[model samples]
Target: MTGSSHPVIDVRDVSKSVNGPEGRLDILSDVAMQVNGGESFAIVGASGSGKTTLLGLLAGLDTPTRGSIQLDGHALEQLDEEARADLRRRLVGFVFQSFHLLPALTAEQNVMLPLELEGNRAAREKARTALEAVGLGPRRSYYPAQLSGGEQQRVAIARAFVHSPRVLFADEPTGNLDRRTGRHVCDLLFALNRDHGTTLVLVTHDLPLAERCARCVQLQEGRLEPLA
Candidate 1:
């Protein structure tokens, strides 16, 4: 599905707003974009510029106040919460700055989660394979508290890719690590993406990291503009 004719993500004339004590505050307005299958792009923006909001909507985790979003041929606005969750499980993976691993679960258990949810009988073996791919096989029994920041993030990455999602949304993937460690984690990310042909959508404020992406778009004033 990497180079499929249909776009993996499509946003059209989308807007999102929420009521504030002062008034209605708009997060995004009239934003539209298309992410081609297997393409990698970063949504770069300063704080409060709505990059994460747009990513959330595109990911079907949040909905637009107006307009439409299509994810892998399904209309986001049309799906109910359950359907949206199903779609996400089938086609999407996520990595966050905080490395949202379950504190009690070991690396292998965390990686097996998605497969277990889908009732996969081979979840244990598959999880081991994913951890190996991220060079975490030896740490499969390690708890999050026992691993370094980069290792925890690698576990998160392994969990994300274990399901072989078509699109992977990463928010500040390298924000919490040292420069050298961040570079190594980034290398693993793009390498796995290349291996699996997953379309990568990363959100970050780091200009250098953004420039490393295949393409980047800036989110400004509640709208998107391609970086020149």
Candidate 2:
């Protein structure tokens, strides 16, 4: 899927800071990284180490206070919020720790949301295929509340992959599951990544999970420390 040597995601001299009650709080500083197309990258850190913050920036959910980021060759800093969102819809998918499924929607509907947002007329059929891919075709009618933790996560995974985005951002994807379930979810994630050639950027506190990525880096005191 990666046809060129250019990076799919690039971050250069990025920093983020916010004004807290006491004073300015620096959450990230001087971060630089590149993730190529079809590659798997991991960011690991302790609590308050800015892992999530960095993930948000990388995914264009937030902007760095200084420096630049490019996603799929688009300069995120040059895009407005609306334009950034449009770019994300066209190229990005996300899976999160809590599953982030809408309780009111059935599994199929949850998986169809992305396509529906894009006005895709075949959303239902595409969603069915995605659910089947995740081995949840038989459970399509179930709501998040009726499903187990692992099942819900699988549905979330289905939703994330249904659109075949160029990039997938997973933040603590298995955090709420038991060890066995976590392992299963992790396997499914990597399988999708490999099979679909999606660039994967994962943020995790689970070291074993981090080790599974092709490259890994740690965020210590808001700075990137390479691990591999």
Candidate 3:
């Protein structure tokens, strides 16, 4: 995926704004970026600088108010919600700081959900393999409430990567863990990305985490800069 002719993520003159009680509020003003497949890109910014909003737009979870976003060469703005979801199932994966695993489902079950949705017949086996990759094979039967924070995050990682997405968007992936545990999670994140050749886009405030990426850009005043 290296030396790719086209970027996996291409955002052109994108902007997002929301209606507030005070009237219209502009969150992100015209910003553009290109991220190649298999490359790690970090988005660092101060709180409320719209980093998360931009990530949401790039992932097709939200549409841009102005301009356009191209993910894996498909124009996001042109797709309907169902089409966007279908495209996400086929190409995108997500990791969040909150470790958004279901409270009721077992670890393996959670990991298998995405595959099941896609009608993959070997969902259970693939989920087990994903669990093994994250070193949670023995804990696959445990539910989220029964696991520690780091372990829960590991399960979320397993769930995210189970279907082998071409791109992974992680938002504050290590924000909930202690230093030692955060480092371990970070290592696992990079390992998963490397092994799968998945494009990595991370939004974080941690300098060390930002440094791990091949390219780091800061969002300031609703804009992206190579250096903040």
Residue by residue across 1-228, what tens digits does model 3's lDDT show? Answer: 352546999999998989999998899998999999888899999899998999999999999999989999999999999999999999999999999998889999999999998899999999999999999999999999999999999999989998888899999999999999999999998887777788889999887898898899999979888864
Each prediction's whole-model lDDT (CA): 0.91, 0.93, 0.91
Q: Residues 1-228, candidate 2, lDDT per residue (tens digit)? A: 442467999999999999999999999999999998898889999989999999999888999999999998899989899999999999999999998898999999999999999999999999999999989999999999999999999999999999999999999999999999999999999998888889899999999999999899999999999875
lDDT of 2 at 175: 90
133-220 in candidate 1: lDDT tens per residue? 9999999999999999999999999999998899999999999999999999989988877777899999999888888877799999
Q: Residue 216 CA error for candidate 1 (Å)?
A: 0.8
The TM-score-based order of candidates, best leading, equals 2, 3, 1
TM-score of 1: 0.97
* Candidates ranked by lDDT: 2, 1, 3
Model 3 alpha-carbon drift over 4 Å, by segment: 1-5
What's the distance in Å from true for residue 120, model 3? 1.3
Q: Please, what's the RMSD in Å of model 3?
A: 1.1
The candidate that wins on lDDT is 2
Instruction: Name the lDDT of candidate 1.
Output: 0.91
